[model samples]
Target: MRSASPAAPKQLSLPRLPVPELGQTLNRYLKSLEPFILEDERHGGLAFQTALNLRKKWADEFATGVGKLCQDRLLALDRASPNNWLEDNFWTNKTYFEWRVPLLVNSNWWLALGDDEHVPLRARENMTDLTPWQVRRAAWLVHRVLSFKHLMDRQELYPETTRTGISLRDSVAKMFNTARIPKPRCDIHSKPPSPTVFNAETQKIYIMVHGWCYAIPVYEPTSPPRLLDVQEIETRMRSAVVDAQKRLASGASAVQIGALTADGRDKWAENLEYLLELSPQNQKTHRTICQSLIGVSLDGPSPTFASVGQRALTSHLHAIRSTHSNIANRIFDKPFTLIVDPSTRAGVSGEHSPCDALVPSMIADWALAEGIELAQFKDKEPAPFPASPPQQENWERLDWVVDEKIKSECVDAMARAKAIIDDSDANVFWFKDYGTDWIKDALKQSPDAYIQMVLQLAYYRTSGEFTATYETALTRMFKRGRTETIRTFTTESRAWVLAMLQTRRNLLHHAIHKHSSLTREATTGRGIDRHLLGLRLMLRPLNGEEAALFDDPLFSRSQEWKLSTSALSAGSLFSGTGFGASYEDGYGINYLAAPDMIKFGIESKSACPYTSTDRLKVAIFDALAELKSLCLATDGAAISQSQRAEISSHL
Candidate 1:
């Protein structure tokens, strides 16, 4: 990228927002993370554990927000349509419900990303012919799945204020963080900067396109992420430098002097003003260069991303989120090899559900139906006497799992809703005083359907998030084989749509084959009870008044989340981060954090509580431990030899 400022602008300028002071410091922080990937070999297991702990921490934080909402004293009051109840872009809910999620998303994910990428993703991909809702719904799923992972438990709903005059500080911080590059040791070995053509080298550009997933806390879906996230990334980087300069100029002590060196804060200001401000220009160039490479990781079973609507759907998603999060959390073991083939390390063979963890209970049912009284030690293996037909045709051929009658019902229900959903001039339907009337009865709508409705709402809301793949709801449906799967579940418009809920149910698996193991859930019911409790807690409304909204059409159901194909991503959400940190590292943002988080591998925390100069080394050590724990565990998380073999065959 050219270093010179773009044709120096005129002196007159538009109104300028106050610069956030942590910008450069944030940029420097991101730069510090660059070394993280490079040093991964030095720290793997610990990183994985750290991720788990982090997920727990985030989950706790989310739960705390819900707890606060539950503590509110508001009662049921019917809100009418055309009232302020469902007004667009307003965060009018109580703080426990509104401020909590906003604070979380803003403080954690939004702030960090603002510091790292500097922008919040805004544009919903606009492809017209495909299922725009599915594309955008996938985005919400990404957010839900990722956020769910951070909390280990599904988070309760929280809300946020309108996007107006949003906080730019978080994004500014993220940009400063993104600009950070690795510090070089006195090098015996170093890759010299690629030679510039003579003096042309100076003009040569390098843009770094960094993508990783993090859980942001938001009470509602509005706030600092009002603009397209990429733009925010670019804008925030510049803002960070300016903020750092101002902070250094103002002499803030807590603002550490220099991340690269122990120089005075003044020196940091100088580097920031001179070196950092121009860094984004280089990054922008580098990003352009790396843009084509963004989808490379899509082919394999890897961690993916989130959607914009997650902030809006807040509590609604918590229902299925428990199971969905679990899938995201534990779905990436070596056994995941079955999701995508091993050869490409990116694409799947589509021989089974991309998430095989979904089929366990079904498999167990199949075995039992055949009168195969499975032995306690038996995995997916048959009993001493096998049934007449070892398996059904549906098992071998992915098609016809359900009868034509079931298929017709589902497809018809989905098609009817599609008619209204596809209309171009449809006004967003909502009513005021919904709390008393609609919200009062809204929960009557199936939670499963409610979950799908939320997703559908999100999809219809924006097409700027992802490219579409299907034409009609019935197109190909699920191939039961290869290619992008799409299908119309029902055209009735109200058949208790639970698009992705089935996925949640699907995630509950039984030990199949030699390598699989069964938990106590098969008989005792204790484990399933606990899981159900966790899910209930996650899905419950903040309080009785808020509960009413669950009944309202505007406040109710939508769509589901699914990766169209193996070519997009192998694993889901935190299961993938650009730096490739272990899932334990993901735990930081994956699950709800608890008091134990203080002991969570120090590196996994948003702000390491440790104040030692050796903090970096300690963090690295913790990450290594987490990775090792992953492979060595028999907790049903470790990838098994048999599972890998099975996956490789499909690949």
Candidate 2:
């Protein structure tokens, strides 16, 4: 009953990330400002006008002028380097993954792969079917992922396109040969910024098995890079795993150098220099590890979904990292990583830069779906092992010169990393009652808009007020673009949530439409949030007076996101995906919507008083229940039909 594979999607020539018109951005900014401006401030007309005019004048004059100059600079960088603008402005300058928290602080995702027994998922709410995996199956699944990597490298892999035909295929290139390199020095005054390097030509993967690690290259270097077959891949993996476990059993001292990557930027810089200064071989070894295309960790074992996700999320935070002293033995800062345990064939853990969550989500989704299909080959002819003699050795164990300094720092880094993991809490749950298709087909509403409404209602019911909410809207419609924040806690949304709570059906549809409209604007690259931030970054050094807008009380308050949520629907296969909250007071919720179910991964600082993932889960369910009841009660209502028509017309 399985369907035939679809034809490959054609790549699109998308336009570059656009700069918003100053006037449009200012108007949007003022609209967002309304909720934050107090009743008292509204009556104090002079002060309000002064503040408004000050922001307007700055946006019109300095911000626009400087924004243009920065845009030009970014354009020049892009011209020099195809995707340099993204790296230079955002990833290079702003993303200090090293300087921030330890490795696990804000950069990892634990994913459970799709299983073949569809009946189990159809039956159980707790999803008890996805546990107790075997080592052979796990190894075979890893080979399946490797095959995916081969397709990805050749650019033959299916490119993801939005319903309206925006091709996101180009972003896949970043998923390989991308890594974060540590700074050479620690001092702010002395050390220049160290950037992550991207080199797709380095078609190699780093594998961590047991407590040991090895680098394995994919190509045979036959004029054009020839990919190794699944048999060869499995052979290499088995050998490597055996050798790794052997070393561990023999009680060989671990280098534990991966700990340096988990430390602060300055500390990492200092340790990196010390490491390089130790020997020429050390430098070569370090480069080999940092520049690899991706990492594949063959973890030991786990029994359940919760056990696997928790083990991957927490253990990868500091355990595998600290235990594997050398970067070669540990997972480096690759754009893509596959952390698979032999015990549980289905789950994979991913670690990457904070902003690039979508890349890993894509990889995970593809791997799980493809993995299931490949598993059907259990009764068929097995893939051939090495056809002829293996060309060149693909695996190498790193030699490290570990000292007292390295050991001391590694211990401290592990402690700090563990503290971060300990302070954070994650909750994973599934809303099996309904999903996107149900919302669209049954209720006749924009699924995304409906979900956003659900989030708004959940937060309102829990907190008793609308705090600033941020929903990441993809602006990849433009070339070399990243993301723009959709200010979800708008006046319309607030009104809608209030009305929805009181079962006031009249305002609910209007609110949903308005929310969808704002989301559309952001999607089209007309959002105010990022434009304003870009302008501020451009004008920061030159104008202190205008820069005062950033320092303003109201401006600062609005920037503090109380409810930070982003959606990644990687079909029904992916049970959940999540990241940490940006601020301590906020809750970070990443929701995955399938055809008939929705999975939410709620995360918050355990210390935060206002937010509890458990309570939020309850609120979210309640909100959905209330909304569903409203839809049923008003099934024959004229407004529902008319509003659906209006929404359909806009689409």
Candidate 3:
């Protein structure tokens, strides 16, 4: 199929993400501090008030001086660098690369799209009944990639926009050929090496099937790029899968190069050099896989209708980036993976990093939409489905030395990776009773704020205290901004939770007001967290006591995100999304909000007894019922038992 780029939107119509006024941001910061301030009189006359006041004053003073200066410097940096200052600074944070392990406890993010969208009958009829559905899936994936590339070329792809009209189109590049390469020892104590971003013109992708990898050259040698037809693409992938399966059956030893990619960079680096030593051919193969556009894992023999439990397992494997059992088939940790579990014709998983989950979710949605349309195309639609194409141009299978030592290491690595997957506790809760739209229409509440409040109530019930929770508010509305952590455990939110529990009616309205205000501040880039982070980053290079602000006990405690949350309103694209908890004792909550239902992908550390997904799910439902009852009670109306039963059944 010929490439047809989507028309780019008018650039002037979109506003650049804005930088907030320092004074305004500081005022919002002060308000956020209200929740954390401890009352001295309640705790046996502890000097908590004095400490809180001191910190507040410090924050007030810093906003006028260093914070303002830092903003100016950040602006200058943004202008001076091709990459936005925040983009470079945030991604290069040593804490993310050096301090955190790229394992189950940190770094890895996972998501799966919804299966609700239907494949039209015309597309079904158009499909060659002879070709396997799974094989056709690979072709569809390639078609989606070509479509995305087309949009990227035309710059027609719509950028993410807030109500204020600020756009985050710049971050879209992370969806393609970028790869997160490990540099374990080169500079472990400092910022890890930036991920490798490849030229988009290189339309080449690696296809992984049955623990074997093959390079698929997607673009033809022409002045302007041309993509291969679906039929041609399908034939090549099917042949490669057959060859890989045959090789496996014949006891051809598979070198588990991918396992190293999952390990700590320093260990990976040493092992990689040793691997290349065993056979020089490995280096070429490694480069080929590493540098490809993206990896499409054509998974075999899995049921199409993967339950939330099955998805959790698959997500774990995908998030691992690469493992021994999956072989070193995955090329990049950051780029999107079109993970097709063919037997069930299920969804795809995008590896997080390089970009946020929303971007990939939209792309996956687009891919699915395109697949459906292509399926419906008329048989005489002039689309070429060749019986065969030049085999050499389509695929290449690399050979590797099968050393016993490598084999042993692969087995051990596989065990370790599998343990993390096995130990993981992922509970997918599909709350079909109602979703964001209902909350908005019924209670006049922001869906996000409503959910955050629900979570606060749930956590309170789970552990009679407010933990440091993080809700990622998109700051992409601001220039070079990434995210601002909306501290969900506010005084207002806590009060609302207490009110719901005690049946204290009037406070719920006030809680919604406060929560929505904080959400606005956070989304508009005036949140306390990112501002403080920027100020701290600026203070790092200074040689004075001001540096102590970062070391302050309050500073450390405030940033300790016990519950890391992100809300992706995937529309109909995802039934659920999930990722690893940011903290060992914490939980990672990625949720999808549809019109009538909201599905939650709750992931927690299995080692943490305090965090149970099942308990949290129940608490969430309880909170929802309690809040609705309280709100409805104001009008002297109560939910009927039958309605409650229906809601309970869906959860």
Candidate 4:
């Protein structure tokens, strides 16, 4: 007999990675995209369509290739003007249609590159045309190369120098000046160079991610992120639930529940009906619905059936009665019963409370039982919850009213929407444990070297716990003469930055121990790489939409696109209120306490995370819309003279 077919390859937790391409794949896509900028078509829609197609191609073709491309491009462009692209000609020319589309597209790719160091190797074998004028320069401008070679190494292709007075850090500082932002270095006590090239080594990928963030300062761009759709939302929700469930099943406590209270059985029926339509055969629609419910419910501490009842509410009983509860029992055996089900006589158990609105610890009973009870988010300082729009949207509305509170509420909602992440050591997984074994993985082996890097500034009052600012810590660093090293940081402080890059990896680290022994910390070397994995998963639906929007020929006109609140979270692209922009702050994970951080600094990718069940989300890239106005050539309001001078000094 044919042995049971080997278990299907485990579904990848991350986004489907595109094949490796040249380091300049983005540069090439920009070249192709550049032509689309000037094609004045007889039909505006046609030009729009062409541009849309170009955007899709760029987004798809160069997405993963962007990290290294951006580092080099920023280095090269830093010479032409400032290293930062936002406050310079790149922004100025785009509005004038002087290949701004290409620059803007380049900006988009730059942000996508993030802080990874391995980017260059992911590109095609040949990385030659990186600085080709055809590919790199804006219209009406000549080419210049101001990257690392001349700055840190002091080597220019041609040597007619006005002054050779600059130091490596001086040149790096210059890149900031050229970009018209505040210079990067502060007045901490200086130390002699490491003598060795590596002063302090961090994971190459983290450094790459860090520098990319510094390049754009784009995460909290003026605008916000976007939302996802029903099916996609359902999938993400289910995945988060599975994440929580695996924890409970293995013996860990649930973090918190965060979702819109389930609609009564009516919504359940509707969702199931929709599924039935998608699968018309004498299908296991009921079983499938229950199956999905089981995944979500099991994540909590209450029996899986209870969680289901809570999410859907009163009619939850009817749905359970009609549903095949056995579907849930297979995963989590709770002696739950639906009054109407033929086999079970267990009637309504208690006054099943409405899934409480997001308040810390409110949903503890039905939500997985874990986490400390925070003060009524209301009772706490109002800082983390920014002022909602003049009008918060009714959750049922389809338009663009994404009340940011909804996200916090939703995250904390079931445990009454609170954050699932916490300060307990159990919630953390120190990277040092992984050793350097990452070198053996085929996917990681052969990473690109860095000429430039990204840095994430995490502000924490130096005490071993979370506090509002990094100012105190910086002062401490200066006092201790350790400002330059991320390594010298105390463990508590390092956890924030680690959380940013590693994201859910910590959760999984805390989790795998309870599920499969192979996944335990002892076997932690078989890793989750959570942040990347979650990003990969979050990207699928976004790419699908990008494909759709890319195909739309009438995409450019004022009427071509619609903006709404839904874009407020995870939609990769949208012209709406910034989706979760506040999340970029250094401690967005504890955002309820500190919202001002959004006004400054590199984003914290770990803040909202994939555990957020809100389908209503968007990508960090959408923030460009807000930043766009700040970028106008004539408008330097956002760029203060002091900041400009600092940027200039580096030049």
Q: Candidate 2, residues 443-486: lDDT per residue as tens digits? A: 67888788888898898788776778889887766665667788
Model 3 residue runs over 4 Å out of place are 1-10, 13-27, 39-48, 60-79, 103-105, 116-131, 159-169, 185-201, 273-280, 302-332, 370-393, 399-405, 540-542, 636-651
After superposition on all CA atoms, what RMSD does each candidate show versus the true structure? 31.0, 7.9, 7.5, 31.7
lDDT of 3 by residue, 1-651 (tens): 989998865445433444556677666655655556542233455355676677667766676666667778767765676545555665445435553353332555555544323333243233322225555655666677667766755555653323222343555555565565555444222122234543332466777766677877777656566776776666677667666766766887456655555555566656666777777778766666555666787655432223346564444334332322443444335356676554324444454555676766666677766443445323423233344434564578865566777777666755666566555666666777777777889887778778887888788789776777898887665555667678887667766665554454445555667778877877765677765665566663544426334555656766778788988864465545677777767778888777788777777777787787778879888887777776665642444566445433311
Give, for candidate 4, the lowest lDDT window spanning 10 residues: 202-211
Residue-by-residue lDDT tens digits, candidate 4, 1-651: 878868753332211212123333323323323222333342254564566566655455434553334334544543554322222323222222222111110111000101112112222122221111111111000001112222333334212232222212232222211111011121111122332443111100000000010000101112221122222222222233233334444675321111221112222233324434554431332222221111112110112222122232222222222122212221111111111111111121111111101110111111212211223122211121112211322111001122344334324322311121111000100111111123223112211000000011112111122222211001111111101101112122233233333222222112222222212211221211221122232234444422332233422221110110010111111101111112222221110111111111111224434222121111221221212222232332344555445432321
Candidate 2 wrong stretches, greater than 4 Å: 1-12, 38-92, 95-99, 116-142, 152-155, 159-167, 184-201, 302-332, 345-355, 372-394, 540-548, 635-651
* Candidate 3, RMSD to the unseen true structure: 7.5
lDDT accuracy of residue 224 in candidate 1: 21
Roughly what TM-score does model 1 have, to 2 decimal places? 0.16
Q: Residue 639 CA error for candidate 1 (Å)? A: 23
Error of 4 at 202 (Å): 41
